[model samples]
Target: MTAAVRPPYRVGIVGCGAISRNHLEAFAALPEAVVVAVCDVDADRARSTAERWGIEHAYGSVEELLAAGVDVVSVCTPHPTHEAVVLASAAAGAHVLCEKPIATDLAAAERMVAACDAAGVRLGVLFQRRFWPAAQRLRAAVDDGTLGRPILGHASVLLHREPEYFSSAAWRGTWASDGGGVLMTQAIHYIDLLQWLMGEAVEVHGHIGTFRHAIEVEDSATAVLKFASGAMATLSASTAASPSLGISIRITGETGATAELSEFPEGTDGRVTIWARGGAIESEQVHPADVDPNVDLAAINGQLIPHHTAQVRDFVSALSANDGTGREPAITGSDATAALRILLAVYESSRTGSPVRLNQTATQEALA
Candidate 1:
């Protein structure tokens, strides 16, 4: 007798944006998954994306995509629109993997999480950077006490974006559409990574300004965070750096050990740039030397396909093992909310000129 082979999960992609390509490519690479359909408000784009990817179906709305059937949905819509798509997908009993920052506000995120839980569906938020080798090593170090009792952390995300970057998309730099600027859009990834390694944030003090960009949202932001485990961290991010410096995160442990992950030239794999313990210190350069500094943003985003593929693979594995003994997604909706909560608190603190505490009431009040 031969063992049975399971059929691949039917995956549906919502939103045919630049980031959607990442999701599509990620799913296309997984043999255990097949993108059966695609949907977008712009029916033409959806049709084109489907045709380009050789998918069989495309629709103008989520309802049509759900009607066509799917086992999983990858939500690639804007930050503010994620909640609706996630809720609808969960209602249709399909597991959802969403782009980061879960939603524009914490309340929406909580509702989406609750809906997924009630529907008995899994909800994953994409923080693909978490899948980076260097990120994994740092997380392992924290978990195994290699960096015993992390006492301090820092993330610097200084990158350049031409004014055209925002002007190109109607929703790019608007609070109403995109949710926020640097802190909400770009830094949220590093914030998620920071909170993931530092445990939980208890308080936040921050400031924001539209230093250079001619947009309604702030182009720059700075914040300090206190974690529940008595660890402290600082975050400074901006789209204002000329010629684009890359992003870096550093962690210092009470055991007198320190490690740093640096992603230089932007949109590249980060490496453990510095690791110091006792009398030993080491550094490794991961990205290519002589790389162009002014690569197009779309090209930069394309570099993240590998990490996206890694996370999508995990999502498929979890769904495939639905026999009650499967591992959950690494970045669940609840796990993602932690970073959103911290960043929202930063926004509130910056507005009110006071340190904001992290709690349900505080979060609700901040959004209110």
Candidate 2:
């Protein structure tokens, strides 16, 4: 007897924006998956993306893409629009791999999760930084007890965004469209990583301000998190740094072992920059000659293709496997929601001038 071969999974991508290229390139790298269609409100952009990627179909709406038939749908739209795309995909019996933050608000996030659960389709979220080799090592240390229960953690995301970056996109800094600013758009990745290593966050006290950018949302923000395991973490993120400092997350264990992961020059491969265990300290030997402040979206997306491909490959494998040995995606809709909850809490805490407790029923009305 021989095992039967399965056909390649059909993929459809919605929203042919700056991030969509990463998803397209990722699927292109996987033989088990083939992108069949793409959709965008801007029909020309969708057709252009399809032509550039050698995809067969391009449409102007999610409904048309769903009608064309797809096994998996990649939601790459802006923050507020994720819900409609995900819901439509799930309703059409397609598995969804949505871009980060899940949704701009908890209410929408919850509905998306519930819809997928009810439809019996998998819902994966893209927190591709988790695929970084350095990030995996830090997670392993905490899991294998090398980090001794991760008592404290800190994540700093100091980078520069040009004024033109926001001006080029109408929704870049608005609370309604892009969600929040530095914390929502940029720091959410590290916040996800921090919470993954530390544990479930129960509360947060935070403040936000627009120091440099003239946008409606905060260009700088700070937050303190209390985890379920009694671990504490502090997060400070800004896009106003002159030369772009890059991102670093440091963790200190109960046993005093410490490790730091650094992603210099932004969007590049992250390195375990610091490690101290058993009175021995190790540090990264090589460092970037200069950090580029002018690194743009296209370059960053190009740099992140490898990580995105890793996650997309995993997602396709999970869908392909049917012999009872299949694994769920590294970041599920529910797993991604944890980070969104924490960030939303930070917004609430900032507005109320007090620590906000993590509650399932809290709506995002306060964020507005």
lDDT of every model, 2 decimals? 0.88, 0.88
How large an RMSD does model 1 have?
4.5
What clash count goes with each model? 0, 0
- Predict model 1's lDDT versus the native: 0.88
Count of backbone collisions in candidate 2: 0
Tens digit of per-residue lDDT, candidate 1, span 1-368: 11112449888999998999999889889899899999999999999998999999999999999989898899998889899999999888888999988999989999999998888888899999999999999999988889987899999998889989998878899999998999888899999999888887888999999979888888999999988777899999999988777889999987879999998878888889999987899977634567766567898899999999999999888776677466578899998898899988888998999999886332433223
Q: Cα RMSD for candidate 2? A: 4.6
Which consecutive 10 residues in model 1 have the weakest lDDT in total? 359-368
Residue 244, model 1, lDDT: 71
lDDT (tens digit, per residue) of candidate 2 on 230-325: 788999999998788788999998878999999887899889999999989998843466555447877888999999999998888777664456
Candidate 1: list runs displaced more than 4 Å.
1-7, 284-289, 360-368
TM-score of each: 0.94, 0.94
